[model samples]
Target: MPFENEFASYEPLRRILDNEKVQQLQDRLKVRAIEHDDETISEEITEKSQVEPSEYQPDMVLAIDGSYQAVKVENGFPGAEIGYVTVASVLILLEKIRELEREEFIDPKQFRETEKAATIDAVFPGCNVIVDDEDSAKSSMRRILFDELKNHIVFSEGETLLDTYEALLKIKLEQKSTPSRCPHDNCDAEFTYDYGEYQCPACGGKLYSSDAMRLHELMNPVGSNGEMYGQIMQTLEKLWLIHILRAFEKKGWLMTLRRVAFMMDGPLAVFSTSSWLTKAIIIELHRLNELAKKFTKQDLILLGIEKTGTFVNHFEDLDTTKEGVADKFPKQAALLLHDEYIKKNIIFSESLKPYGKDTYFGRKFFYKTSLGYKIVPSVAFFNEYQQNLTTARPNQFTRLADVMSLLDQVVSSRYKNAVTPLVSAHAEASIPLNLGRRIFEDIAREIREQS
Candidate 1:
């Protein structure tokens, strides 16, 4: 539950929906609708409700991958691109979980009302303590049980149930191991008579000894490094994943009954490249997905997104004059389906695609067994910059000032309700604002000359 709460805090849907820009767009749409007839308005609403045209069916699964990097700061001052985190999530629906509760065979109500049932005080005399609330009582019970278990429990391989029973039996047997009062007037130590004389390790004071010391030791055992950090990371990752899954489910994805898969950006084993804490977190994610599948009867798809630009260069071979420029993007070529149903018949591969004039980018290739075409966006077109009207990184923009001026022209002269302000804000925080503005102006001048 705590994890669920934490995950909701990071979701961006609420922010995007509530944005002023989005509100303005809706307002404009409303005005436009008023100008149209009632029949036209109804048609518009119906069209908006229909699913967008796509080669694949709406039932197809989605796979997501996210990557994060810490932005380096100078003397605590944030630099451009600093504090900027990018996440890409792919979703693949493969299976779903059915809700079911394990049945309790016996009637607990009848057992509770029976006279033969044991009372708390009768079974454990003097063990009861006063508590301010029910929560405190439960906490006290847990502490007592934990302390008792740690003191006398010894486990063996494949003996989990037997070990628990033996532990309980040991606790019952040692219930009479209460400490004896010290005879020394100067000292306040308590000890058992069976253990002979007792002395405080810190002070030279002598006293009687008992089994209470063992209980104290058991209640405060030291934990290992792997257990502490591992548990924390595991909890965080599971909560985050669940939150995303729930969001998709709410968006009409059949997450509960259909098989779903996630594509992670890294290796399957987190410990391979990531920290031990990170590995623990990923393992927890795997466990949660497994549990989700079991409950929903859905299968999960997990794939790691990889890049091979280091070994091969495909940019040299791509012809820039291709008709479907948008269809040649590397990412489009590398698209993989996590669903088992899709994978069994699809021959998945990867190709190095050219971006701009020289850059090599990763592309996914999915060939279906059935006769149909899968259209994907081109790598070069996807990477192009609208402000510059050029295929270059923001930092590489030659006339940044010109680019901003061009953007201004587009916003003022063409689209009145454009979201350029938001885009400019993001660019300002990421790239050199002055340079970007110049590049925009130059781009605008180029377009004007061409026209």
Candidate 2:
């Protein structure tokens, strides 16, 4: 058919759209309106009781963010793909912020130009042609992930990022042995071995400590590894926080930990292919916080700030007027989202598992800062896994007031509904699509020529 003929006649599309079964399906997927004000739901949002800033406010902030991109290197049979991931952690001192407030001239670039940025290259099986079997992609990915985790320089030369990874894997998961099925094609033998490097006995396939992330499950011989690369970026962001904090702990910098609020660009939860790491992270952070309290007489401040998501949307909706009624979520208040509220209002479905039960390491809350930024923040508690959602209150998050107070300082004008440190971290980590693709393409061309 001609282009105009196809455009003019929508008979086939109309038949599908006008079908009764399609209408029923649409009804099932429709989003429900958020309730403006109801007595039962109102309990979730608790107005800030702390009229004064808490005694223990963080003097320094470390924010982590990451970005990733993948490109096809070749297009014919036995094609190839490569991915690049950049994770950046920016350190913002309150003193420098105060200097800015004092109108002292200091270049803003200094804040983002910290020594905590790392770029990792991911090569798939087709891209390298170093494989003996179909499982080569998984094997190669596992090696790259392990080597990067073990060698990436983060804060200083005193320790590698793997030290944090290994420490947490030991302290939280308490894994006596790391186990995995053979990554060799046609060899489905499962094996369990002690931590560190090992090989599958049945197939002589190599294994890695980073295998705990289970990212290999997402790998294939030749296809898009975007999702897997994304998960790696998220994992790196989370590890960067723990790595620096652990470094501080090792150096007896408990007071520094207490006075520094570690911020991440997204939620504290690890989801999808790497969800299993969430529980271990939660336990590790809880332990670190407890240790900080025991030694420094205050809890370490660490939280994740979301720039945008479903929860943020729900929060914006809550603040809007409905039928001449006042805002549902008041300013300077934080709402600890429980399972019932999230299921009913946000996801619009009921599930046997509680909201974020399997995937989340922290409790997510909707906060309207005292300065009026509607933000979603996730906070982890030692008892987060043990406590019932029905009984937990906003007050249980001891650092909520301090976090809100700190957020007021970093609210960004450069980005909509984002904080300064995260904005800076993102800028430092991001790869320009046009420039990056051109560079990757050039590199791919050189490789093709050399071959």
Candidate 3:
């Protein structure tokens, strides 16, 4: 009996490790590392690169991010879930009226601060609760999603942005072929829905329910309020702003993206949960870029930055090798940039790796703005850089050398490998350290009389 119990303990882990689903994960992945280069930085990295910076400058730099806190819903609705969220977006004008550049000999705390630093901001704060019924929960979640979008959508008297947005949403969902499958993971049989009552043929279960009996099964559907759904709320919030920006582009109100850069907190790769939204955005952007010549306009500038990466750690060594004759330690860095660097030093893999075979939504590159501090720059510049700016032809290389050209305006002395505009935006957007807990207390007191 002791032996039987001991064997059973090990079996669970072994089964989990060697399970068919687990094995499928390993088969789908491959690793890529930076081909170690033995060259040190002998000269300034800016000198050797062959590319020119655009003469244009952004009129504004806008940055957006969201924060959320989960709370307990204890009022009569038993199986109900509750959460609160705050999304902040900040705008910094690239072109400003003349202002004092600096206070002559300022205190350390306020020295780098400028009167023009912070500009317009959009902050979203709200709570969400899901009760026992599947349909009721869906309605609640959908209301939160659309309410946020409608509140944020910019408009004028004549042009209707909201109407256009709804049309786009319909097209996005229909084109992507939203999956219809049994809500039960174990009985995930596919089906077609005509917006009518249904039951799972395979399990003889309620496919669409208004009660707790179907809670677990209901979690598998696309819009279900489960773990993945919670994770996706942030992405959905982001896409709402993107859709609005694209709508503006269509109306010719913002004739030029060159005068603006949109900064997001992360990469452009859209995950499976929101692939439909991603597809629609990409398709629309492509169409606009194709007609760019006719409109005499430029493409959108979206920048996603990460402060750390595999190549970042590798740059600590800076590829040093002893030379012939003089044998002096050179300042030349390996600079594992977009082209050859992605082949070797990519850090993530499997499901979390860079989006597969599709050329990245934005090309990934690396830069060392300061010694020993490295960063991964995810910029959309490469997609349009294929030609020599005269002939329409693919450049032999990624031609990301010019990206660092704007570093002078983008970099900040306050943070390593970070742009100043983003830092300011993040500071303004962030919820205070304990504000979520305080807000939760306030809600508990108001709603349930206890905290």
Candidate 4:
């Protein structure tokens, strides 16, 4: 029979569906049921009303968010992919947020005056951009990243984003060299960096501060660079956060740093190949907080609020209740999960490897606002992987009271457990997914045809 006439040949589909062994296999899978009104759980939940208030209201909130898309062109001889990343930081006055909150209805005229913030976008080469030349894609991508990093004007006085990246690396990891290998094919020669800039002695290829991210390792001649795109977006988002804060400090604007709450779109963690940057970020955050404390007697209000992930699921489970049962996790409360709780409940691992030890710059806390929004906010800590840290641990929840205060004013019903600044940041950073991919594909096809 021809392949086109073989549609109904699979009799095993019915057998597989009727198999009792499949059901039994699922039954044997280990999955913890959500607990409601348990003693151990109750100890972790600290109601917001019970915690002491900071009386520290922020004047402004800066939310940073990013998005990335990769498009593959099927029409090309060897096929190709193009990736784009957009990152935006939006600054909105706290008074405006409060005004909007007080008034149940939003007014169109209230937004007549527009505000400008930082936006950084980049297009990257992926897959077989250069059909005949394999090394061209890798070399071109490296050059593009180098140009993008150093060329962007982050400060009015002529400081670039590359400068900020180098400064951060120097302050944090300059004492210890970061190791990496050359990206050139067949030349996996190892090297170390005391700082951001280094030239590969083996291949004589130039490296920039952006290379420290090691995103190039994810790039290849044939495979898609979609992963690299996401990694780059993340790295850029983090850099933007530090760049803006560094700018404020450079201009002697400690007051702005003190009264401003910088909201990040995701957890304060850098994962995958870029995870090494977490140490640098944690150290920098501490340095900045210390600087603000020295001048303003307060720490900088910076937080990463996650909308989705494993912790969000755990938080949702905690907030839920059976029909007759009382609430599992009370409203207006914050639960800081220790390593034991996380391992036993969330990650399903009793492994000795501490959770988020290598990747996380901050510790995660599940907080339910006074208005009943479940928020997973991660704040930078001096040492998140300390032994014997628990929910009742003191000094771990630094500026947490202020975070709760800020949450009360900016609740959003647009999405479940959403906040306004993040909503704004998302809108600013969002790209049209399907339409963007189609457009890029068409452009790629056209370029291929012309060439």
Candidate 5:
């Protein structure tokens, strides 16, 4: 009876380790690791035999694209405008990798080959071959470049660049007599076709293919809601997953070699986005935590940075009820609640702090939270902009401060409204204020425990 009771006490941890779902996850991890090894060997042999010595160093880089299409502009600004921004973060073991010998860096390409091979092997294995004896290494590489690299490089058309790469690679593959075939179902067709159109003789199915379509498919596959809203949600979810993985890979490599610090440019959570998308992203992130433990054997710490002045001052000035305060607390509070919900659910790293307010040309006062950091807009930049026949500088500052100040107030007001008969009947369901507060407290507690 004592032994049984003790075993029952171990249930939670044991479920994490010994459950069937956990075993399946472990099996997938093992398979992935084996596949990664094979890919590593192939890449090492290929790079060592072909690539020049200079290219062998750890020059691998990751770039991400963040774009916002303004569907509706407030206060008589342009009705719609698409703002495109690209964020590129470099991950290099500058201190550690540089310490290797010149021979280690160049001669047999040991260092370069090892890292590249490991990345290739670990991220994706068995990607170079097809089931039917067709050598698809070039196409596989094209898919990777198109799906991962192009969109992140904002200046060029990702699809166009991928197309050019595929064409060049196809030429090389053709010279080696590798068979290129259509991937359509029930079609046993092979053609040394160029970059454009191919028609299947066996099934009459037209293949209008390009690297762009391939990338799109990766994000929004066929038979899985390709509507614009669906695509946007899918893209955001993919970005969230990729961001976590990339962060892990960055941190994992650093910790593997014993490094202390790392930095990120923006907040831990991606705010100014949709609520549904945010919730979906957080769900995927939770799943990623399980996946990361199985694959990398590391816990992810996503620390959000905030500025004390911004967080405290904004909350303080939410209402015009006080001197030096402005109105507009309602909408702002809603936005904060939305963001809080996201922060409560997603998991990330803890190595860096977030800045919440701008103090100088280059520096700012930063704050850290369980979710991530808060980044402030520069006064000078906002001052230069004109919106609704008024300088946006004052409005932006006032609105931001108001929103921060009124978060709790607005939430309280909303809670009262939810209880009101008219709204309660009209609205099928509403998130209670107490429940929201409890969620916030729970997240704070979890973060504190982890810290």
Candidate 6:
């Protein structure tokens, strides 16, 4: 009965209606309604922009991503958590889609016969972290997960699994100690663990990392949360790809690096505990590029393509914002979703947060493909974080300045916001239930054995 509960509360909703924050939002919404009313506002259509013929092209493109989820064992015990797993995958596009764009005419018959490519998928079987076995699972399963992920990793020449893992551990150590996750899975709270704090200030529970040297009882009992664990998996997946791609520099094969574009499945920026690793990656790429340019023909064509976000959700609904303006609103074509446009359209405005200014390792921008589908794309660059979020212009960029030629690398015809390679990669990387279930059975066994 202690672990069980019933929900029968509309009181919170009623209270929220009267809350100051809610009232302020209501006042703001009312003003927005008046300002953006169709009768009072002026609008115009935004014409499509043209993409120039390829100034540059990549012969191949690669994409990398991972799927992760955790499953709790309700039948096991009162307070027991269960299993977590991650499946990392990489997809390589060997065929060049840009070739079709360059060709004067596409003869369907010739196209079918002569040139076509599919994404080559390499799956990292899967890795499991035993969170709970319904009994006493004290085994260090996180290490096992990390180890297996490294073992199954695929990278280009000159990269090693051991080196990648050591790098990952270094990142884990570098994370800031304060403001960490709460000990309870349901409560995402952070407070001072300093000053001999024995329990989570938020839930009176505790949490921990899987450090063997420390006594488990001395540390917070609960381990990483779902979000943090997924991030850890993603961190490994990201580093694996970066290291592999970087090995090309050691190969000194400018021809391959030039013809190859790498598409990461998420935003160019790293988040959570993995941010340090991303920062290091940014620095390393700059260093490698500085040395490789003299030997290689062109800069690496790397991109991060995202299907959704705050910008994606709102902009997906609006092609152009022209309220109270002439026919001069910036078209949503490879432009930064500028602050002005954000104010004008007012699409999903309440959800927008004060931009946490991390100088992007990649330049973020929106692009409307030839097929008229809007997608966000980012190209890598060495940049620093901007801590102040109040500036009028938050460093929103239209497209990458230095990587102008790389824009040509995106192949747009059959697809909308996505390049052809990313689509294939996604297909390959998607974790089916059978292939990547949470390691519940393994977790249960481990806990039972330990008990």
lDDT of each: 0.27, 0.67, 0.44, 0.70, 0.28, 0.46
Off by over 4 Å in 2: 1-16, 27-44, 49-53, 74-78, 104-135, 155-157, 171-179, 323-328, 384-387, 431-451
Off-target runs (Cα >4 Å) in candidate 1 are 1-83, 88-259, 269-273, 277-286, 295-298, 309-451
Lowest summed-lDDT stretch of 10 residues in model 5? 116-125
Q: Write the per-residue lDDT of candidate 3 for residues 54-82, one digit (tens) a residue.
A: 45545455665555544445555544445
Question: Which candidate leads in lDDT?
Answer: 4
Task: Locate the minimum summed-lDDT window of 10 residues in model 1.
Answer: 116-125
Model 5: lDDT equals: 0.28
Per-residue lDDT for 1-451 in model 2, tens only? 5675455557878999999999999989767765636665566567666444557677666677888877666545464676678776555666656755666566767643322333333333324334444345567667777777776644344577877787766754564455567656779998763357887788776777677777778765556777877888888888877776666666565655656677788888888766767777777877787878876676666678887888878777777666645355667777777777788788776667777877776677777766677778877666654335555564567567787777777777677668887876687678522222213223222222322
Error of 5 at 448 (Å): 32
Native-referenced Cα lDDT, model 2 = 0.67
Report the lDDT tens digits of candidate 6 across residue range 3-101: 458765789779988899988888776343333433322232222333332334554445665655545445433334433444333333334334554
Q: After superposition, how far is residue 377 of candidate 3 from its true place, in Å?
A: 1.3
Top TM-score hit = 4
RMSD of each: 28.0, 8.0, 11.1, 8.1, 27.1, 11.5
How many clashing pairs in candidate 4? 1
How big is the positional error of residue 379 in model 3, measured in Å on the Cα after superposition?
1.3
lDDT of 1 by residue, 70-178 (tens): 2333333223111122222222111110011133453555432211100000000011221233122223323333333233211121222223323323343354445
lDDT of 5 by residue, 1-451 (tens): 4564454556678778878988888777622112223243223121111212221111121212122221222333322211121222223223323355433335445443222100110011122222223234223423433344333321121233234334333544444544445545456677543454455556664443343223222322212212322333223323433443433443343222111111222233333222222333344444544554454343332222222343334333322343555442322112221122212222222323222111111111111111222222121111212111121222322123322221211111333211111122112112121211212222222222322
Instruction: List clash counts for every candidate, in order.
Output: 74, 0, 13, 1, 18, 3
Query: How far does residue 183 in candidate 6 sit from its true spot (Å)?
Result: 13
Q: In candidate 2, which residue pairs get closer than 3 Å at backbone N, Cα or C atoms, i.e. clash?
A: none
In candidate 6, which residue pairs clash? 59-259, 207-220, 359-385
Q: What TM-score quantifies how close candidate 1 is to the native fold?
A: 0.23
